[model samples]
Target chain A: MTETWIILGATSSIARAFIRQEAANGSGFLLCGRDMDDIAATAADARLRGAPMAEAMAFDARQPDTFAPILDRAASLSGAVSVAVFVGSMPEQAAIDADPAMIAGVVTDSFTGPAQFLTAIAPMMETRGAGRVVGVGSVAGDRGRLGNYVYGASKAGFATYLSGLRNRLGRSGVHVMTVKPGPVDTAMTWGGPKQPLSTTPEVVARDIARGLAKRRNVIYTAGIWRLVMAVVRAIPEPIFKKMTF
Target chain B: MRWKEMELAGWGRALKSTAAVARPERRSALAGAAAPAIGNRRSYGDAALNGGGKVIDMTRLDRVLELEAATGLLRVEAGARIGELAQLLAPRGWLPAVMPGTGFATVGGCIAMDVHGKNHHGAGSFGMHLAEIELIVGGEARPIGPDDPLWRATIGGLGQTGIITAATLRLIPAKGRTMRVREQRVEGWDEHIALLDSSDASYTVGWIDATATGARLGRGILEEGEISDASLPPAGRSRKVPLDAPGFALSSPVVRVFNAAYYARVPAQGRTVTRAQADFFFPLDRIHDWNRLYGKRGFHQFQCVVPPAQKDALRDMLRAIAQSGLASPLAVLKRMGPGRAGMLSFPMEGYTLAVDFPNRAAARSLIAALEDLAIAAEGRIYFAKDSLAGAAQVRAMYPELADWQAAVSAADPDRALETDIVRRLRLRDPA
Candidate 1:
């Protein structure tokens, strides 16, 4: 059976690396993203790398109108129709503080928008009774810090939603994984201050593949992040509120 | 991110640069400025560095867009590694026509340097296999074909003719994924030259012991390989150089012992062995960050090509290196065909010698003397490996320098694509 992956936010660095790895495994791909040009290039690369089928489609997280065509395309394909959501946005805390309106876009791009798409496609995945859903969240979501709490809050919501989705879909033989990675050396963190123990997109992709193979739920990349976040989450609310990262 | 400030260096670690770098991951993102673009920065010296200016990092843009199975033509991005391409295509019975010594060398860097491989005697330089190049000129993509004069300037032009976005390469049909290699010991300079000159294998290379002198001069191993479909165990895991080695790690006595053991490793009668294709081509790559073996002070590699008639000049140069007691274990000598695709391409009908030396005052002076000898013999130094050649001496070596300069100047009037090597050698300046 051909496993067709409906990759959301296909232009993200981690997503691109993940797509390359899967393409080599002879998987099919429906690459969806805002930048059609970039997605088209990745599709061509996937085809050359041994993907059985690869197509690019327009997808904008802020607009729900773009989700149906992608879901319909996945339904038209045979075999397992999996989806990996790498959609997220991180505007500087200072920028969000200046304009509160930016908060909505952040939440929509990271949480509500992807959740809506997944909610619409859930029945299709359940009917097939075989597929994987990989939702990429950040370690920052484990405990919001002063640096970028809005973005952290969005990922936190997405992570929580994935936990519920996993419970609902696990009964039907589908797997849902929540990946909480620390700062990855991608465009999101490129020019920012040096991130502690920051890993590359390639590393994150490899971790995701390992997590999927093991059928693990809620795994932390760079595994050190799990311990670090554990200590952070244990801190008392009063002290944590007064401290800054 | 659009840009990031960082310090980078070439493979030799002898030259450093602090620049604002923008690593665009997509073709659409590469449409901005006509800045100098660098791939894996595999050049041993400053060929890929631009001191305090801006540079475009093309490593992330690597991808193979298309492969025509019938004609064996591959349309690939500039940042794709040569080794990765071979690994991807070999199982399908095709390979990039020419691959440099290190598989980590990117397609763009190979084109800019006109790198040669063990098959240089037959397949020629990397640029000779290019069917078309999608070069970013004046912030727009333009396809450059063989008939265009810019084509000559771009290949081996040292990235001065604008950024190379992607290219169409003519891949050759490969027999299999493994190699049948025959290794033999050669004693004395005459036998070494005789063996290299007479070899007709698809891939041939001579590993000379740079520390040997007198009656044993030029004694080392010669490896000739042919692709085969033989089954072999998977290669072992690659090891990494954890830290900088001490100065004595490659000292004269230590290197001599290592060389003797390496030479003796091959039986006195010689033998044929099977090796993975990558293991045969990129032996040093097995040790990740092998450059750290040179220690913190770094090292320099002196590579030069002299016409077949100038054998004595090369021998004298080697003798000088042997007496200096500064040579490292990495040294090579090979015969090249008269096949070059650029005005300043590095290949000619000659024998090329390359030797690595720790960055010391004595090594610096020895390399300078060798450069002068190369000039006297009408030979040329490889810009990709040189870090100390004088500007005027280099200008005299390449007769077509003026023509390259004219084409490059016309392509980049503001000199936005100039690199450290281009600036150091004064390649764009007319006498």
Candidate 2:
């Protein structure tokens, strides 16, 4: 049976790496992203790498119109349809602080935008009832940090939404996995201070594959982040507020 | 485009640079991004380094864009790896015409170096098989072919003419994914050369024991290979060198013992085996970061080719390397054809010798001595493997350097593409 992955934010480093791995396994792809050129390039790469079928389409988290075409395309394709959401934005804390109104965009890019799309596709996935949904959240969602609490809060909200979605979909045979990755060496972390225990997108992609196979919910990549985040979440609010990462 | 500050080095690790690097996954980001585009950083010396400057890492842009199986023509982005291409196409009975010792080498690097493969005597260098080249010139992408005036300079041009973005290569068809190899022990220098000259196999190369002296000098194994539909087991997982090995790990005594065991493994009567294509072509690739075995200080590879008439000079060079007791176990000898696409291409209708030496004052002097021998024998040292060659010595070796410089100067008038190797060799300056 053919398995088509409807990948959102397809141009993200982690998404690209994940697509390559899945392509080699003969899975097809619907690469949806804002930059059609970049998505098309990745689609071509995916097809050449062994994907049975790969196509590119426009998608923007902030735009609802863009979401319908992708979901419609997924509906048109036969066989099992999976979705992987690798969408999110992280503007610098200083930049967000300068214009407090930027929080709306952050929430849209990270939380509400993807959640709305998932809600639209949830029924279709439940009807078929045999596929996986991988939502890439950040470890920052485990608890708000002093550095960039707004971005963290957006991811926290997204994580909660995925949790509720998983609860609703588990009975229908559709698996929803929430991936909490630590700092990945992507464009977002390129010029920043060396992040502790930072891993590559390829590593995170492999971890997601492993987690999906085990039907994991809310897994931390690099595995060590699970314990690290546990320690962070346990700290009292009084002590945590005084601390800075 | 976000430019990140990074400290990078070539494979040799002897020369390093801190540069602002932009890694663009999209082709659109390549325009007006940076100069002296680099891929994989597989070059052993300064060819890939741009100290205190800016560079665009092209590895992320790699993709197999198109393929015409009937014509055996494959179009790929410049950053695509040769080994990956081989792995992808070999099952379909096709492969890149030329692959270097390491599979990690990128197509752009292969064109810039005009790299030769084990089948050099038959297929020639990588550029000879190229049908089309797409270069980023003057902030715009331009497609050119072999008939273009810039062809000679761009191939083996050390990436001086322009930033290579993509190419259409005429890939060769393969009979199968397995390589049927024949191995034999060559007892001495003369016999080794004679055996290589007599061999008519599709692929032929000799592994030299650089530590061998006197009668055993130049003694090693000669491997001849041909593609066949023979079944072979899957390859094992690759192992990586976790850290820099201690100095004693590759000392003279240790190398001698390792070389001896490696030679003995082939046996006196020799053996025939069916091996994976990658295992036959890129034996060292199974050991990731093998350079770390040379220790923290790193090492240098001296590769030079001399005319058939200067065989005695090569023998003397080998004798010197053997006597120095500084040579690493990684040594290779092969006979090359006179097929070269670019003016500065390293191939000649003669014998080529390559040996690795741990970086030390003694090894440095030995390499310098070998460079002089190469120049004296009317031979040229490979720029891809050279880090110590003086400008005057290198200039004397490549007679067509003037022609290449003229073409490069016209293509990149601002000299914005000049790399450390270009500056170090003074390649574009007036003689």
Candidate 3:
């Protein structure tokens, strides 16, 4: 059977690489992004890479209703969604300091909205007795960083929600995965200061594909991030608070 | 040997006779004529069953084929049990890197399943250590190495490619008889993940009860340990279980109570150290029809590995099980090692959880649901313990399925060796 993957936030460079990889691996995909034109470009790229099928769908992560129709359309085209990759969310620091309206939109887009979208499609995946849901979280969610507490907190909530979703859907045959990518050099973090463990979108995308194929529950885009997080989590809170990133 | 006729899964009860087969010692006796072979029947699927075909039970072929301690390479007959090999090698300061839950499984069976153990997150599958497999392909015994395409096919081929007569396994130097075991109980799912995420041990495993709900859902015992070379001590020999117990033994009430107590006995706190054998590899020889406790219907085990990217998915899985009300008594979670090259191999660097459900009629749906979830996650089921996963799902889960099938087909075009599972999965075209 031809496996089908639905990529949320398809415009992201990492998501683009994931689409290319899946396409190269002979799988079909539905690319969903904020702009229809961007998704169309991605679909064209995926199709050129040898994807059995590739299509673009306009999506706004802030709007949960947009997902229902997209999911329906994917199902109508294919039998079911084999994998769903969510990579749409606002930057961490901006969401934290933004106005109440901006914060609400960030929280919804990052956590609540994705949760609703997942909740909507999770049943269909479960009822079909097979599917995978991949949520793109950040290493910032590992702990509250002073620089981006708001984005980190939202991602933390999303990561925690994915954990609960995984537990709920485990026995039903639906897999939910949370990806915690360390500092990735993407549009979201373009101007951000380069860190010791900053990774590229291609690297994160490869790790995501590998993690998805393995059905891993939580994956660090770069394996080193696991160790980095371990050390970060181990530092005494008093000591951690004094250190500047 | 009919699985349906024997008791299994640690309950010491007997199952009704759905099928039976007997192979006398004479039939299994090694002949000078190229050593005729048959697939190990331990496979849960039809890949091991040869419809009325003459099956030379390799279990009796139990003999040390080769052992090179200096090179850390040991070749043993297909019939040699893993427990037997462990006992033989443990004293020689060597041990198999990857061992499945049950030592009763034969070396060939391990290779067929590409079995993984608690240390899989670091050590990969049993097939990774397989230097080469000696197989009887089309009436000829040929040694296939890792580089050979047939090697990958047979490793996790479910015995579809050929009859594995012997295997040259890679062995690791043992540190000692003692193992420093540390046990801890995490409060919530997030903490549990954090704990697993943090630990780097030779062996690590978590036992959780899916029936536990709310804050207690993912709560369970986490045991992490490493071989204690400094505290080396002479190991004591173990006694074998000779026969099956009578029916009516190990009732559901008794098991439920025992399970409850076992879960309760675990202290809700940090770590404790214990003996290596007891900690890393206990219950070694409790293999007397352990599955009988589920009664006559038998049971199905759902084992899947969720990649780290999909780690949160496990929470959803746990919740679904709790809601389903299946009441799985034995649920084990562990971190798997890196991926292997076996076409149908189950290795994925991630966390794997295995749960057992009694073979009630409801179990069929539950198993199917679990399979679907695994596939959706892009996770594949362990073929060794699975009896119900459909062929299409299996193909979908394992991306290397087509490659493995092609290799097996190329190696044995005539399809000389066939089993019930191979037929069920249509591993080979119908003759």
For B131-188, candidate 2 gives per-residue lDDT tens digits of 9999987778899998999998899999888889999999888989999999999999
Q: Between 1 and 2, whose TM-score is larger?
A: 1
Candidate number with greatest DockQ: 1
Provide the lowest-lDDT 10-residue window in model 3 chain B. Answer: B7-16
Candidate 3 reaches a DockQ of 0.00
lDDT by residue (tens digit), candidate 1, B1-431: 38888888888888888888888877787775778999998798888888888899999888888899999999999999999999999999999899899999999999999889999999999999999998988777899999988999999989999899889999999989999999999997899999999999999999999999999999999999999999899889999999999999999999999999999999989999999999999899889999999898889999999999998899999999999999999999999998899999999999999999998899999999999999999899998898888799898889999999999988899989988888899999887
Q: What C-alpha lDDT does candidate 2 achieve relative to the native structure? A: 0.91
Best by lDDT: 1
Greater-DockQ candidate between 1 and 3: 1
Task: Give the true-structure RMSD of model 1.
Answer: 1.1
| lDDT, candidate 1, A132-228, per-residue tens | 9999999989988999999999999999999999999999999999999998988778778888988988999999999999999989998899999
- For each candidate, give its TM-score against the true structure: 0.99, 0.98, 0.57
Q: For candidate 1, what is the total of clashing residue pairs?
A: 0
lDDT by residue for model 3 (A1-245), tens: 67788887777767766776678788888888676755665675566456778888777777666887787876676454765555546654655565656777767777887787777777778887776888898888888878877777888999999999999999897878889988776556543455677887779778877887788999997789999999999999999999877
Regions of model 2 farther than 4 Å from truth: none
Q: Chain A TM-score for model 3, please?
A: 0.92
Give the distance in Å from residue B65's predicted Cα in candidate 2 to where it truly belongs: 1.4
